[model samples]
Target: MAYEIMFASFTFFSIMRYLITRFTIPDAVQHKWRWYNVWISWIHALCAGLGCIYCVSIEPTLLNNLQDYDIRFAYNLIEMSTGYFWYDAIDVGVLSGSSLKESLILLCHHFVVILCFTVVVVTGDHVPIAIVCLLVEINSIFLHARQIFRMAKIYDGPFYTVNKIFNIITFFMFRFVSLSWMLRRVILDRSELSIGYFILLVTSFPLMIVINFGLFLQVLAKDVPAFTVLQKLQGSKNQNRKEKDACETLNGHMNGTHQTKPVMKAEVVSKLE
Candidate 1:
C-alpha cells in the first residue's frame, strides 16, 4: 500500500511539472534565479528523508527511497527517464578564479571513488561499498561547492553563498548519517547484510546510472522523437477506429437488418430522381 501510494504521488508530480512547463508556466522563474541552490537542497532533503524512512519502513534499506529522491524521482517504477530527474546536465566547468587543475582532480577523484565502489559491487564485497559511496559523495559535494563558490560573484547579494553553504553542510551530514546506519546494520548481523540486499543495491544503482546516461545522450543528440512518435501512434489509432466503424456498418447492412437510406413513397422517389 505504501509503495503504491508513493508511486502514484511521484507520477502525479512528474506529469504536473511537465504540463506546467509545456503550457502554463512562463519560460522564466518569478524570482529570476536559477535553481542551482534549490536543486542541491532538494538532494540533501531526499537523502536524509529516505535514509530516515528506510530505518522506519518495513521494506528494504531506505536505499530504494534514497535512489528515488536522489535520482530526482519519487519512484523509479518506470524504466524510462520520465523527466522526473535533474534537468541540468552534470556540469564539469568551474567558475572564474577556480583552479582548473583542482576541478580536474576532483572530477578524477569522483570517477575513481565510484569506480572502486563499482568494483566492490562486482566482486560482491558489500563491506567497503558503504565506505566508497561515502567518499564519492563527499567528492561530489566538493565539486558542487567549487562551482557555487566560483559562481558566487555572478549571484546577487550573499544569498548564493549562504544557501550553498547550507546545502553542502546538510548534504555531508545526511550522507554520513546514512553511512553510519548501514555500518550499524552490517555490524549487528552478518546475515542482515546478505547478498540479497547487496544484489538489490548493485542492480538498482547501475540500472539508474545507465538509464540516466542514455537519456542524457539522447537529449544531446536531439534524437528523442517522443512527440513525433506520439503523433504517429495517435494517427494509427484514429485510422483503426474509422476502419472498425466501417466494418460494423457493413456487417449491419449485409446482414439484411436495416436499409441504407430512409424509406420514401414511389412518387417522392421518382420526383427526387
Candidate 2:
C-alpha cells in the first residue's frame, strides 16, 4: 500500500509537472529539465513535512521507545517520501544534466536514506525512524524554498534571506537535537533489534549526521558569508559615491564665489578710477 501510494503520487506529479510547465510555467521551461527535478524535490519535501507534523501531533510519545512502535499511516507517509527520493535519484542522476560529482553525492544520500528507511519499515521498528524522518524532512521544506528562490533569481532578496534563516534554524534544531536524542537511545536503551540491524542503524545514522554537518558548515562559512560581504561592498560603493557628489557640489560653490568676487572687484576698481 505504501509503495502503491508513493508510486502513484510520483507518477501523478511527474505528468502534472510536464503538462503544467510545458503550457503554463515559463520559468520551468527556461530551466529545461532541471526544473522537473526541483519539482520532485519540492513535492517530496511537502509530503515529508506534513507527514512528520501529523505523526508528532497524533503520537507525541512515539520517539520514547526507539525499537518498539506500531506502524501507522504516518509511517507509511514517511516511507512514501523515500520513494520520491528513489525516483529522483534515478531521474536526476540520469537526466538532470548535473556534474558527475554532484549526481553521485545526491544519489549516495538518497540511497543511504532509502536503505535506512527500508530496514526500519521492514523490521517494524519504526519509532526511531519516525523521529529521524521528523528531524530530517521538516527542514527540507525551507531548503527547497531556497533552491526555488535561487532558480527564480530572487535568492538575494528579502524573502530568500528569510527562508535561508529559517532553513538554518530548523537545520540546527532538528538535526542536532534529534541526533543527540538518538545517540542517547543507542547508549542507554536496550532493544531486541538484530545485530545486523543495529549495526546498519548505528553506521548510517551518524554518517548522515556527518554529511549534514559538513553541508551546514558550507552554508555558514561559505554561502552566507559571501552574501554578507557582497552587501557590505555594495554599501561601501554607495557611500563613496555620495561622498564624491558632496565634494563636487562644494567645489562648484567655491568656484562660483571666487568668479563672482573677481567680477565685483573689477567693477569697484573701474568706478573708483
Candidate 3:
C-alpha cells in the first residue's frame, strides 16, 4: 500500500508538471522554470495540508498515543509526501536551473524528511508524530502561494496583501507554535520513546527549528514594517556607496590617474531587478 501510494503521488506530480509546462506561459521568461515548480508545490501543499487535518480529525486519539498508534491512512499520507519530496529534490537539484546554494539547502531538507518518513514507514512506528510534523505543510500552502503571486507579478493590491497576512499568521500558528509544542512533548516523553526515535527527534527538530526560523525571518523582512524599514535603510546605504564609487571613478578619469577600480553593483540590486 505504501509503495502504491508513493508511486501514485510521483505520477500525479509528474502529470502536474507536464500539464503546467505545456499549458501555461509564465509572466516572465526567467520565471518559466520556477513557475512550474511553484504551481506543483502549491498543489502538494494543499493536498498534504488538508490530508493531515482530515487524518487527525478522524484519529484524534493518535495524538494521545503518539508512540504506538498506527493509521493506514496516515502512513499513506506520509508515503505520498515522501514521494513528492523525492520528485521535488530531483526536479530542483538536477532538472531545474536552481543555483548550487539553493539546490543544496532544499536537497538537505528533502533528505532529512525522506529519511525520517522512511523510518516511520518501515518500522510502522511514530506515525502520529510524523503527522504532527506534517502539519507545517498547512503553512506551506500560503508560502508557495506567495511565491506564485510573486512569479505572476501580483505584488501590490488587496489580494496579495491578504495572502501575505495569511502567510504570516499560518507561519506562526502551524510552523512556529506547533513545532514548539511538539518539541516540549518530545522532551517530556523522552523516557518512553525508543533510542532511535529519540535520536531522530533530537537531531531533526533542531535542524527544522533553524530552517524554519530562517524562513520566518525572511517572511518578516518582506512583510513586517520594522524589517522593511531596516531593508530600506540598507538599500539607501548601498545606493550611497554606489554613488561614492562612481564619483571616485569620475575623479580618476578627470585626473588621468587610471587607478580607481570600477564599482560592482550590489547583488541585492541585481536580485530585485
Candidate 4:
C-alpha cells in the first residue's frame, strides 16, 4: 500500500511537472527540456531524501542497534524512496536523452537501489543500509542545483560559483563519510546480519560509490581543462590551418605567374595599342 501510494504520487508529480513547465515556463521548456525534468526531479529527490533522513535519525534505527530497527515508519520511508528511485531511473533516462551507456548506468543504479531496499522492506531488517544509501541525496541537492543553473544559463554567474563549491564539498563529505560508516558497520558487525543481506548491502553500497566517483572524475575532466587545454588545442589547430592556407596561396600565385608570364607582355602591348 505504501509503495502504491508513493508510486502514484511520483507519477502524478511527473505529469504535473510536465504540464507546469510546458505551460507556465514555456520558454525554459522550449529551450531546455532536459533541464525542466532535472528541476522537477530535483525537488522530488530533495523531499524524499529529507523524509528518509529525518525518519532514520529520529527512529532508534541508527542508535547503536541495527537489529532493533523494526519500525513501520522506517519501512514505509524506504518503500517510498524505492518508488522515487524507480521514477528517477525511467524519467532521467528518457528525458536526458543521455548516451546508451550513460542511460544504462543510471538505470542499473536505480535497479540496485530499488531491489536492495525492497528486500529490506520485506525482511524488515537492514533498514540502516537503506537509510545510509539515501544520504547520497544530501549531495544530490547541490549537484542538481548546479545542473539547474547550468541548464538555465546561469553557470557563468556568481551564484553558480558558490553552488559549484557547495556541490563539491557536499559530494565529498556525504559520499566519504557515509561510505566509511558503512564500511565500519560491515567490518565490526558482520555477525549480526545474514550472509545474503550482508552481501547485497556490501555490493550495492560500493557499486554506488564507484559509479559516483567515476562521474565526479568525469565532471572534473570536462569542466576544468575545457576552459584551458581544449581552448589552447583549438587555437593551435586554427593557427596551423592558417599557416597551411598561406603557403597554399603563395604556391598558387607562383604557378599562375609562371603560366601567364610568357603571354602577358604581348597581351598587354596589344591592348595598349
Candidate 5:
C-alpha cells in the first residue's frame, strides 16, 4: 500500500505539472518551466502540510511515543512526500538548465530526505517521527508561495507582505521549534529506538539544524531589507510629526505674547482713565 501510494503520488504530481504547464501558465510568462516546477512544489507543500496536520491532530499522542505509534495516514503522507521529493530531484537537478554547482545543495537535501523516508517506509519504524518531520512542509507552504509570488513579479503588496510574515514565522515554528522538539524526543527515547534509527537521527539532526539555520539566515537576508525600509519610512514620519508639533508650539507662544500685550495696554488705558 505504501509503495503503491508512493508511485501514485509521483504520477499525480507529474500529471499536475504537465497540466499546469500546458494550460494554466500563460505563454507570455518568462521562465515558464521554473514556474511550473515551483507550482508543483507549492501544491505538494499544501497537500503535505494539511495532511501532516490532520495526521497529527487525529493522533496527538504520537508525539509522546515517536517509536511506538503508527498510523496508516502517517505512513501514506511520508510516502507521498517521498514521491514528490523524488520527482523534484529529477526535475530540478537533471531536467532543469541549472548548473550542477547551483543545484548541489538542493539535490543533496532531496537525497537526504528520500533516503531517510525510504528507511522509515521500509522498516515501518519511526513513522511518527517522520510525520513530525513532515510538519516542516507547513512552512514550505509559505516558502513556496514566496517563490510563486516572486515569479509572478509580485515583490510587494498586502498579499505578499502577509505571506512573507507567515513564511518567516512558520520557518521558525515548524523548522526550528518543531525540529528542536523532535531532537529532544530522540534524545529522551534513545534507549527505545533501534541502533540504526538512533544513528540516523543522530546523524540527521545536525545536518537538519545547519541547513535550516542557513536557510533561515537567507530568508532573513531577503526579507529584512523590507523591514529596514519600513523602519526608515517610520522614522521619517516620526521626524515630520515632531517638526509639526514644534511649529504648533512656536505659533501658540507667539499668539499668547500678542494677546498678553493687548491686555496689558487695555489695563494701562483703564488706569489712565
Candidate 6:
C-alpha cells in the first residue's frame, strides 16, 4: 500500500510534468529526436511496469507451476535482488537497444522476474521492492527536468520564459524530497539496501548509461538540420567576402591604369584641337 500510494503520487507528478514539458517546448523541439527518445522510453516503461504488475498479481501460482523450484528460485533471486538497480543503470546505458522494441524487452524482464520469484517465493516480502520502485519513479522526474529547461532555453517558444523556470525548480524539489526519503530508508538499514547493492553488483547501470548516451545521439541527429543551415550561412558569408575583395582589386587596377595613361590622353586631345 505504501508503494502504491507513493508510486501513484509520483505518476501523477510525472503526468503533470509531461504536460508542462509539452506546453513549454516548441512543437519542433518537442517532436524532434529528444522527444521521440523520451516517447519510446515512456512507452517501454509503461509496458514493463504494467507487465511486472501483472506478474505480481499472479505470483501465487508461479511457484507451483515451475518445473524446477531451485532453478526458478535462482532466477528469482538474481532478478529481484538486482531489479530496481538494473533498471536505472540501464536507463543511462550506452546502447539504445531498440526504441521500437520496448514492449518485447519489458515482457522478457517480467518473465525473468517471475522465474526468479518461483525459486524462493516469500509471500509477504514484496513491500520493500514496491516502495523502491515508487521512489525510483519519483527520482526519474529529475531526469526530465533538465531536458525541459535546456530545450526551452534553446527554442524560446511556448512557456519558454520566466514562469517555466519555476516549474523546473519545482521538479528539482520533488526529486530531492522523494530521493532523500528513499536514501534515508536505505541508509539506516540493511533491508533497504537494494539500490546500493545493485549499484555494486549489477551491469544494469552501465546499460542505462548507454541508453542516455544513445538519447543524446538522437538529439544530435535532430540538431543536424539546424547545424547544416548554420554551416551554409557561414559558407555564404565567406563567398561574399571573396567576391567583394575581387571586385575591389579589379577597380583598383583600372584606377591605376587610368592614372598612368592620363598624359597620353591629354597630348592626343591637344593635337585634335
- The global Cα lDDT (0 to 1) of model 5 is 0.86
lDDT of each: 0.41, 0.70, 0.85, 0.73, 0.86, 0.42
Winner on TM-score (2 vs 3): 3
Worst lDDT run of 10 residues, candidate 5, spans: 254-263
lDDT of 3 by residue, 135-244 (tens): 99999999999988877777779988998999999999888788777877888888878888788887888888889899998888877889989988999999999999
TM-score to native of every candidate shown: 0.31, 0.73, 0.81, 0.71, 0.79, 0.30
In TM-score terms, candidate 4 sits at 0.71
- Residue 65 accuracy (lDDT) in model 4: 60
**Best candidate per TM-score, number?**
3
Q: What is the lDDT of residue 18 in candidate 2?
A: 69
TM-score-superior candidate, 2 or 5: 5
Clashes of each: 0, 0, 0, 0, 0, 22
- By lDDT, the best candidate is 5
**Alpha carbon lDDT of residue 113, candidate 5?**
86
Candidate 5 or 2, higher lDDT: 5
Candidate 1: regions farther than 4 A off? 19-156, 199-273
Give per-residue lDDT, candidate 4, residue 37.
Answer: 67
lDDT by residue (101-170, candidate 1, tens digit) is: 7455435433443443333333334423333244323424433443444444333347545644554454
Cα-based RMSD of the predictions, in order? 21.0, 15.9, 7.3, 13.5, 15.2, 19.3
The reply for model 2, stretches above 4 Å from the true place, is: 23-31, 221-223, 226-273
**Local accuracy of candidate 2 as per-residue lDDT tens digits, 153-271:** 66476888888898999888777778767766765654656677667767866777888888787667544887668777999999999999678767878786434675589789999
Candidate 5 lDDT, 180-255, residue by residue in tens: 8998989888998888878888788778878999888777767789756776799999999999967876787888
Better of 4 and 5 by TM-score: 5
Error of 2 at 241 (Å): 35
In candidate 2, residue 214 scores what lDDT?
A: 80
Better of 2 and 4 by lDDT: 4
Off by over 4 Å in 4: 24-33, 56-63, 70-72, 92-99, 221-273
